[model samples]
Target: MGDIQAYLASKYMSGAKADAILSRSEAGRPKKKKRRIDQAVPVAVGDGTGLLIADEDSLGNGWGQAEPEEEDTDVPVVTAAAKTLRLKKSNWSLPSASSSTQPEPAAEEPPAESSTATATSAPPVKKRKGGLLTAAQLKEEAEALAIEEARKEAEREQERLEARRRRRAEGIEDDEDLANDDDDDVDDHPDHQRTVYRDRSGKIVDAQAERAEQIKAEAEDRARQAAKKDWNKGLVQRNQREVEAQRERQVASTSFARSANDRDMNDELRNEVRREDPAAAFLTQRKKKGPQRPKYTGPAPPPNRFGIPPGFRWDGVDRSTGYEAKLFQKINERSRKAKEAYQWSTEEM
Candidate 1:
């Protein structure tokens, strides 16, 4: 009966269920396999007693192993807890409480490739000891720079002023030399001496009077010369006009005399013809018997009183007697005498 019950339980129950029942039943029993120094072991001293034990190897290993696992077995396992425990033991091991409580070490940073590049390719930045300056120091530096610029500017201005002064001195020397040369020239020529005249009040008056007289004489001379030129021009023009008129009159007189002579000859010839041919003369008389107006024999109207007729004199004097004409003649005579006197005075001066 006992063997049959064992067989039935073995066939029907799982390995884990069997183990659990056995562990409960054999609570005071020792495990078969002993743990190594780096291993974890769970021991059952009695009912409800669970104890874990770790060795020096477990303490020495700071972290659990993380290596890759081998391939799983093809056959299915009957105990999940056992398989899990094995996997835990192979892949990882828990640390002691003291070790777990300790802080972990920080990861080391990777070395930079740029550090070597920078050292080789670039110059180092120099640190200035006096990088940060005080307000007083800054002010002093600015004032020093300003003073330096001002000094340089003043030096340049001084140089320019010195150059101008030198030029002015040279110009003054040249002027003095020129004055001396002029003085020497004046001293060398006695005939070209510059006369300095001084005039008192009376001498000034005499000079002014002489100047006025000279000006007046010059004016009179100009007037006389102008009047003479005008009079000559008028005389020439008047003579030309008279000559033209005489020529025209001569021409007219010659033509009239020729006509008269021709007429007289014709009359004498006509009278001879009349005496020689009384019958012809009687015929001519009969032809000339037409009525004719009497000839105007009265003297022609008096010539234009104001304007001179052809053949009349062109003298500027009027022969008629009137107060105005006499007055005009007197004015002409006075003007002529005045012109003659002016001419004489200018000649004498």
Candidate 2:
């Protein structure tokens, strides 16, 4: 039985196949060769115990080996039986404790692929909200721009006004030329009050008065030359003739030379007469007689045909009139006033 169990384990054969093959063993059934376990099968008597039978000739050497194996009393039979049982147990295997309950490794590959796809397929990002300008900042920028534009506009206006003022100063425009053209306004003598030298009818000049002025001027020149040692005698003689001719135009005096007593008496009498008939008294009387010059309220008038009054205008009427009339009135008024003011100031000085 032990030998049959060992054979079943070694051959990895089923129990039924092993039994059938054992039955077909010619030595066990009809061969001339001996089979010990088959022969002893009928003699086996208990569990865990088996018998072995041999022919007399085979037993002679095996009996001596059995005797030697049995010397320890627990040798050959127990060894063989334990070996066979161990082999049989190996053939009929049992499940390991670690095998049936363990779990498989998880699928990490899909998750890794999903992460890669998400990274590659996303859209481009927009900028953050903090970069944009605030409302107050935008308003301030607009105000600054407006101020700069206004400043430029003001500068342009000033330049235009300055250019116009320069043109007017240079007499480039008609309006400006009229304001400066009044020669009567300027003082004639430069140092004295401007005396209007009008005629006897307050129109034509007095020839006698003009001649007296020439004689007075010649006398003054002769006195100056007489004082100088390098006086030109020829110039003196020529000037004397001019003075004689001028004297003839005035009223003539009979006695040419005067005595010392007569000269002194005459000078005293003349002084007394001049003191009585003062020049200021004469002018004041004259002013009271004629109409005073009209006061001017603005500039001078423009020229017209025949050089009469300037342009046509009215005396005591509404000032705001047509363009040419208003222009002439302003010019005439300014010129008249300027002349009067110049004369008054020079007289005061």
TM-score of 1: 0.13
User: Model 2 reaches what TM-score against the true structure?
Assistant: 0.13
Against the hidden reference, what TM-scores do the models get? Answer: 0.13, 0.13
Per-residue CA lDDT of model 1 for 1-349, tens digit only, reads: 5444445556677787665655554564444433222233332232223443434343334454323324345344343342255433222334565665345567987678777766654333333346788888777676766666776798898986676578678875466556756888988897556443446643423446677999999999999997787675777787897898987886676644455557645765666644456577346452367787554344342344354343333343445547655666788899999999999999967
Question: For each candidate, how many residue pairs have backbone atoms clashing (under 3 Å)?
Answer: 0, 10
lDDT of each: 0.58, 0.56
Question: Between which residue pairs do clashes occur in model 2?
Answer: 199-204, 298-334, 299-330, 299-331, 299-332, 299-334, 300-331, 300-332, 301-331, 301-332
- Per-candidate RMSD vs. true structure? 44.0, 48.9
Q: Compare the candidates by lDDT and give the number of the best one.
A: 1
Report the lDDT tens digits of candidate 2 across residue range 1-349: 7556546655877677666665555336433433222112112123223433323542435443322222322223323332243321111223466656345566666677788878864343333346678898777666766666776788898887687679878867665435444534554546346354685577856567899999999999998876674454577886897787876764255366667778645765545534446564544332357666655444554444345452343453444447666677898999999999999999967
